[model samples]
Target chain A: MRQILSQFGTDCDSGAAPRTMENWYEHREMIEINIVVCIKQVPGTTEIKIDPQTNTLIREGIESIINPFDTYAVEEAVRIKERIAQQSKEGFSGPESKVIAITMGPPQAENILREAISVGVDIGVLLSDRALAGADTLATSFTLAKAIRKLEREFGKISLILCGRQTLDGDTGQVGPELAQQLNLPCLGYVIEVMEIDNKYFKLKRLMEDRYEVFRVPLPAVISVSKGINEPRVPSLRGAMRAKSAPITVWRVSDLDVKSEEVGLSGSATQVIKVFSPHIERQSEIFTGDVDTQVEKLTQKLQSLGVV
Target chain B: MDYFLSDEQKMIVDIARKIAQEKIVPVRKELDEKEEFPHEIIKEIARADLFALFVPEEYGGLGGRIFDVCLAVEELSKGCLGVATSYAASGLGFLPIIISGSEEQKKKYLSDLASGKKLAAFGLTEPDAGSDASAIRTSAVLDGDEYVLNGTKQWISNGGEADIYTIFAMTDKTKGARGASTFIVEKGTPGFSFGKKEEKLGIRASVTRELIFENCRIPRENLISREGMGFIIAMRTLDKARPAVGAQAVGVAQAALDESIKFAKTRHQFGVSISSFQSIQHMLADMATQIEAARALVYAAAKMIDSGAKEISAASSMAKLFASDVAMKVTIDAVQIFGGYGYMREYPVEKMMRDAKITQIYEGTNQIQRNIIASHLLKSA
Candidate 1:
């Protein structure tokens, strides 16, 4: 898998290239750093409950969590806002940074978005409608990009877009990069550490297979975070109480000022033709012997499978 | 600290109960019989960020007050008391160092423990000192820069699996309670080993073993309180921990009552369900009432602990005594309600009945609790 991915690795691996020169803080005397963290609500796993009688998913009892990976994205956005607020207080007075969490899922996902707000995000927006039920990655990205643009129009120009590396249910790792591509934003993936940040630029350590590469990405860049990007903090009791009634803005395709054909099934490029449980076959041969004999048997077994 | 929980407590309770009922109920029997610890369940709870409820925020903990831990304990225990007790004891073994340790100790231990990378065990009850903990014969002799500990602690929960331990040993054997001191002994010390695992009748899934410290040497910094403050420190830790035990009892009792009620209404006897019998109905009613009342006391004690009230010890003892006794009674009644089937191992109520028995034995027996309550009463007199 590593070799396969590395075969397609682009200049994205280059630590140089200076992706964007537009530094918001240096350009304007100040810039409002509005961040929209794109999150998704997905069935946490493929092993979902099926109603035996109906041969359909029992959605009522099923749980929809904030895509597990997205939590790190939401956390990073909130953390950056906190860092900005603290920096501003320490006479590094910059325009106040704000984190607005946006999720495109069913209306029930409002709960998770509200949870994000409780964990110190400034605002929450949910894009939900019956039309978005069968969205593939491409359509999901299009819908999210439009929603981000709409948010920029209503709030302000968002400087940073953050998301998880991939959703647990999808595992495609395409939505975040696709969204960034649609927005024409420079995208960085597998961020492990946020080393330092001022208003205009942020230094981060992007995790690679063998080592970590440090990069100073300019503002407005979309960064996909891996897990272990600093342990996500739990919401305090007071924070949870505040989140219980947090206002969540709901949107639809019409709200995003986008064409309906660019969403849902019509907008999808790829379709899953069929899904079935994979057949698993297991065979075991017990090697009964002393240590030397056992080692010989193991080596023979590995060689038999072309693994040694 | 207030008796009324903020909305967070209620929400946690709701989530935990749903997971317990929907996820844990079906698999609990198999897990128990096979003696398989549910590592995945603990991982799920960890993902929920439950393991840090008591540690302060600076140490990467949630800094949730004692009340929240108790509330969560009750809910989690309802799923499986063994798991809940093991999880909650993580707090018990760490909260002391968190609440009283020097900054160096806090930085050294709290973060790792809070992150669930390490498990902690609290050691105070020795074989001879189960009820009268002042009778502990374990001695910690200051030798050069190290303290040599030699003792045996019995029935220590998480004994075999713990990475760190909060141990109490006598620094001056003559002074009884005053001469005892607390020490934080990391596992894998040369002389710190555990005995065979206890084959428990209840909570068998939770690892319990005898902790043996034979000249286990630790740095001087491992000492928790001042040289003579061991008993006082141990008491303080128990004051915080007792309510959690009570909450565990409540969880066990609540599970029993719920299962019993469900069974009674469905299981028919004499062509008319036993639930229709006035006597059986009375038992169910009593069980429900007892569980609710025990819950109230447990929550109240938890609130008292959180508030830092002077009455905390008394309240904790009251809650522990009442709730655990209620668990014993309620579980027995639940088993009785099941009639012949309740005696069978297949029914969940039977396991609940077995599991509920240990709540009275640990966290200071009900007799010791009464003694503490009586002491508080007589002291005022």
Candidate 2:
């Protein structure tokens, strides 16, 4: 099904002639800055089963949900768009903004993109291809970076990119920084609050292991946020209805200027050899007779174990 | 059990359920305890376009579908009947205008109501009138280009909190019920005011108060329909709104049953889960069955109304009457199953039980619903 859509790639992949300087000048007048949020569809259940041979979670049977942390990212992106749009409402014709969410997974992953739209996302982009399966953080970030560049070319200047700090199942907090590295853009992770933002810079507060660090980062940067940044809104009825019929922009590997060797699993620098659930064992001993006897027995055992 | 809902219907249910579970459920207990209005939650509902469900698409709504409205109401009712009442009562207030208003009225008022930019209330019952709605003494006398309204409308849902009110008043005292007329009254109109908010036995999150009009002046254009059509409009509005009440009952009952089942499974006595006991099992089975039956009836009644059939009085009343009784019984049974825990404020079944009673009493008491049904039955005879 996705193969048919990949053939008629929408928006940016027309492969048309590069616009002349005149066209760029005309388009630059609007100054429509786009906000891109990267999301993933992960298992919605805790009963996840790992495929030992493939070292991946089996996707069948389980319900898919937007990675929990990603919801906060989507909320923040929508909020930024809303804030910018408010200025437009207040008669500031500085620039119009749109929140475009992009996800890379199976065609079924399009559900998450629609879910994103149901809560005020303007557009959704799906990067689906069979070859993109079994990707490590490196390949995932590389492919996402390519998708981001493609989005930037089509949607105009992307002022900020937002992503969840990490995916639930993967729990590897590398994609945001790696994608930023791939794009040669500044990146910040673990952002708790956005204090302020203007055309050029963002004042951000980030919670670390023990203290808080604030940064005034430049625009055109990628930032991954932890949960609790903001509460994601429930889908509005109109938004849900809109999402039901809204067109999902599909991007194939061919849609991007990407080599087959550097676009999917083959693009990764590392691979998982094995996956297993960690087993925990607990041993208990019951001491009888009296409280003193039990205490003495416990102390003797603790002493034998070299605790004192 | 699958209801085999259409994709659109499923979407409506899913969205409402998300709001109910994620937004309403967490704060419902506190709201009930404080007797405070669910203002933030109502704003959330408005933001979600729930207020637009039963309005026409031309008026910035999804579409006028009573069935779709019922689906949303039921899900929300499961979270908190008080919050659901606040949401559904707005729809109730819109019924008069949607059913019988002029084009100018629809164009002027519906857009705001449909977009949830404003809330509305229906004022029909008076201090002396409940089941005998025609006994209302509120009078709207035509004076020059405006109608001067006087008298108090008691127990109005949404009351002062709503921006718009569809008020029923007597245009001719000698004509009795036939002399009634309905008019649109904005909240801050001259000589219009609200009495103190009423304390309620249940559904505490919804605001209710008396609408007092002391020679309140409204333009003649605010009249909903011709004089003497007030009774018909009120009856029709109630009929159209009955399914939603039925849905509310089903929702509250379903919540009670859910609490019962959840509690029963974990609650242990005599070395076993209470759910294993025959008495508890039978009660659960009965509660589940009655709820499904009520749901099916509510769905059918709403569908019949939305099919543009005007002769839906019997069906709508039956849906409301049966479902409310079932809600009352089921909630009582749920509390019984929970034993002592159910009666405590810490648990939810007592609140469900409290909320369920109003469904039977309001929207025309169950006795009135039965009378309407019986009249329809005998008329067919």
Candidate 3:
């Protein structure tokens, strides 16, 4: 195998194979892995206010950041790629892999793509169009699936898809499952750790409320990563500078070859009619007594109110 | 009046500000109280690629300039001046190599420094030479393949922790100021050792110690450029680095003013918020104006240096002098605005006041900075 590879005129001696040869070798080995990370840009501040009348976020003067959870997905994808590359260098013959970050929002959402690139993503693709505004979870998932297919067309078959368990703003843990359904792939939710992975299968730890279960899943799957996957690495200065000049592939609704009525707000099965802040009424009752009596009274009040 | 930052500059500032707020601010008080060297925070900063801001791209750096360094320093200093000093002092340490180092020397030293794999320290000031750098008593005698150095360097920032030191010593005693030469000394050289750490008043979170060189031998190739060029290199490196100190001052001042404004609006006096009072309003106004002016000067000096200006001593000194003064005044006024609470450590204003004092003293005292400005003015006149 080494002789055949060397005969291909690959400068493998320098440890950096040419892109075309590397891709060709991956194809021949039947172990190429492409990972697509679905990310979103949300308001930076947690103190977000919704305009009661308009039912829209007060976005003016607010900065946007990549959804906090999605950062873990990005970090995990990069880590997997790095681990595979390391293994290949150590003669384990692991799959050649790439981590591509994708997002769907307005053109300004490109910022998050650049940010992900700075962290370690190999490629950034933005699905931005006016028609894609006000997308519900289902519509967003559909759009992301289309984007992933587009990426596969350009690169190669994607072996895995990753997303955060839920977005901070929407808090809907639906996109990963919906996207899996759209793409006809097996879905793994709340994946806290990737125990081991090879070309054909992955061993993962699925986090649960009371316990964690280990599962062995086949390749070509979707995983919605939980926060405990890993601590995301900060962007290196060199990576940040590269990201500043990196060309982000921008896809419109047309680019995805989707029907106008099958995406964005128009394609949504559900629409939010009203958004309002829940009203909280504050009431204080003073209990004047000795310490033990006050404690007894508080415990009785808590039991009566079912607060225990 | 029109100050515009490029997209890249804005991105750099944003990243630094995020690290400052998320990592530095939380540990600042504890670090200051314990006088602990912020190893973890520094590692985070290194991971963030901030160490490469001022290094050239060919030398494994980000290819940014002095302006970028100033921008990062300003943001980081806003959280804690001590942390910012640790960050900026490394730049001061390695800048001599960047300014006058040979291609070989740069490749050897700057690559590691730029990658943040190793930290660097500048050692121009000694026990006898603080503002008077020409009075440095450290002597380096020529050997077959090395220069054997003998002297003690005082008040070196990042002294004990840094892996490399750009030290200056007299190579030819007969030449007076012209006799000095700079050499790169690795931390673990045979006779080189560190003295006790100094307990400082402000910027206490940063390490300061004496670098004692008793027959500390370094290869002749470690000498920067040529012999008898040490004073000039040291001066030039300081000229380039002074604006960053200005940026630190600006950050401290801005933080103080921000605290003052927030305090004034919330703290009530005579049935109204103190901000509504004329006296408080005037103080806030003056603080805001001074901080803005100092920031403007610092930015201008940084840009001038980045633009490859040949003579920028006056501008750099002016920036350092004015910004440090503004930092001191604004922090004091912030305390005044906070009234009695400002005097207490519970409020952040007192810490800001403490942190603001060192910007006036180190990197050349404000008095020495005034002297540089006067000299420049006289030469031009």
Quote the chain B TM-score of every prediction. 0.95, 0.99, 0.98
Residue A167 lDDT, candidate 1, scale 0-100: 78
Q: Write the per-residue lDDT of candidate 3 for residues B165-201, one digit (tens) a residue.
A: 9999999989988999999999899999999999988
**Which segments of model 1 are wrong by more than 4 Å?**
A1-109, A115-125, A128-308, B1-4
* Fnat of each prediction, in sequence: 0.04, 0.88, 0.50
Task: List DockQ, one per candidate, in order.
Answer: 0.07, 0.64, 0.43
Cα-based TM-score, every candidate: 0.66, 0.91, 0.84
Question: What tens digits encode model 2's per-residue C-alpha lDDT throughout A1-308?
Answer: 35323433431277744555335333223334588999999999988888878777789888999999999999999888777676445433554688999999999999999999999999999999988888889999899989888887888888899999899999998999998999899999999999886778888988898998999999889999978688889998778889999999998988988888886768778888877668889898888979999899989999999998
| Cα error of candidate 1 at position A76, Å | 17
Model 3 RMSD vs true structure: 5.6
lDDT of 1 by residue, B1-381 (tens): 245656667766765665566556667887778766666666556645567677788988777577778878888788888888788877888867976688989989987776677888999888789888999999999999999999899888888788989999999988979999989999999999999888878776677889999989999999985899888888888888898899999999988888888998898879988889999989988988888899899888888777778767788999999999999999999889888899999888888888888889888899999999999999989
Q: Quick one: best lDDT, which candidate?
A: 2
Ranking by TM-score: 2, 3, 1
Model 1: share of native contacts present? 0.04
Model 2, position A254: C-alpha lDDT score: 87
In the range B1-381, model 2's lDDT, one tens digit per residue, is 677889888888998999999999999999999999888888888888888897999877889899999999999999999999988999999889999999999999898887788999999999899999999999999999999999999999899889999999999989999999999999889999999999999999999999999989999999988988899899999999999999999999999999999999999999999999999999999999999999999999999998999789999999999999999999999999999999899999999999899999988999999999999999999
| lDDT by residue (tens digit), candidate 1, A2-83 | 4323422433365434333233224223435788898877775577754465332345656888888888998898888887
